[model samples]
Target: MLEAANLTKKYKGLTAVDSYSLRVLPGRIHGLIGPNGAGKTTVFNMLTSLVEPTEGRVLFRGEPITGKRPDRIAKLGLARTFQNIRLFKELTVLDNILVAAQIHKQYGFFSAMLGLPSYTREEKALHHNAIRLLEEVGLAGLAHHKARSLSYGNQRKLEIARALALAPKLLLLDEPAAGMNPNESMELMGMIRSIRDRYDLSILVIEHDIPFVMQLCEHIQVLNYGQLIAEGNPEEVRSNPEVIKAYLGRSAEHA
Candidate 1:
């Protein structure tokens, strides 16, 4: 569903990402992993157009989307959640989702301001869609509750629901397992798999959770020092000498 070709990002004296490329097939889950400075996030930023790549282009379903604005890319069926949970903290869970659902809504200012029939119709549809996403994310019961009132796990789920509100064909999850307990991460694993099939969308996940990524992704790509180092399935990546050496070196450095 998505193809990144020769993606590179250079910041004056620093080359954050260099000559990286990967393919995300339709309806498949692809994973990216690397040690801390491997430019995993940089690659994601380029894909989503958060930051322009110095060189390289991204194609979504064979259409070039390189250098597109984030909002434009979003409207073109690409959506993502950050490594940090971002939500409308004060808004109700349903409201938070409603905000994202509006991306596809065509209710013009005049129609909404005048409460025209068209606006009303669009709103009803949005509400229905929001509720349905809530149910799918297992947050139906808490739709009316303030987002801040939910526990951490539920907050994470709420963010995911908000992203789903965009009706994206490609969902980029950045560190979905970050800051979650074992139980929560395990639940997220199941949720990711379920959504891939349920929504019929491709997913590209960047995660530090090795086991989770391995089990969740059908294909994997590894990065090191902002460059492509390895790419394969879970077992193949796990057994790769460079990947092993990188992790072991990281462990030793921390020790």
Candidate 2:
């Protein structure tokens, strides 16, 4: 559903991502893994056009989206979460989701201001969808709580749930398991897989949790020094000599 071809990003004399390329197929999960400073997040930025690529292009469902405005890309059914948890800390958890879910509203400002029937209908729908998403992410009971009041792991889940409010066809998750424990990560894997099947969308996740990515993704890509060193299934990548040397050993604590 998403294809990034020969993506490269350079900041001054340093190359962050060098000729990186990968594809995410419909209804499947893909993983991008690398050690620190390997430019995995750079690839995500280039793909979503948050940072313009120095070279190469990104295609979503066969159409070129390289250099498009991030909001425009999002409107086309692509959504992503950041490596660091980002939330409307002051807003209620339900409001945070409603903010994203309302992006699909069909009514105009004047309609909303005037409280037209169209605005009312769409607003009602958005509210229902927002609550449903909260339930899916196991945050239903905290719907009215401020985002900042949630625990670290719960904040992560809230971010993912907010992304889902976009109704994206493809989701890019950067380190969704960053602060979770083993059992929590395991539960996250199940949630991610279930969401993929339930929503019928593709997912590309960047994570340091080796076991988490290995078991969750059907395909994996490894990067080191801004270049892809290996791309394969879990066992194939786990046994790769270069991948082991460049990243596996460093990430063994998570294994």
TM-score winner: 2
Which lDDT value does model 2 have at 148? 100
**Superposed Cα deviation of residue 121, candidate 2 (Å):** 0.8
lDDT of 1 by residue, 139-234 (tens): 999999999999988888888889999999999999988888998899999998999899998999999988889989989999989988788989
Estimate the Cα RMSD of every predicted model relative to the unseen true structure: 2.5, 2.6
Which segments of model 1 are wrong by more than 4 Å?
250-255
| Span of ten consecutive residues with least summed lDDT in model 1 | 246-255
lDDT of 2 by residue, 1-54 (tens): 998889999989899999988889899899999999889999999999999999
With a 3 Å backbone cut-off (N, CA, C), the pairs that clash in candidate 2 are none
Q: How many residue pairs clash in each candidate?
A: 0, 0
Q: State each model's CA lDDT, in order.
A: 0.90, 0.92
10 residues in a row with least lDDT, candidate 2: 246-255
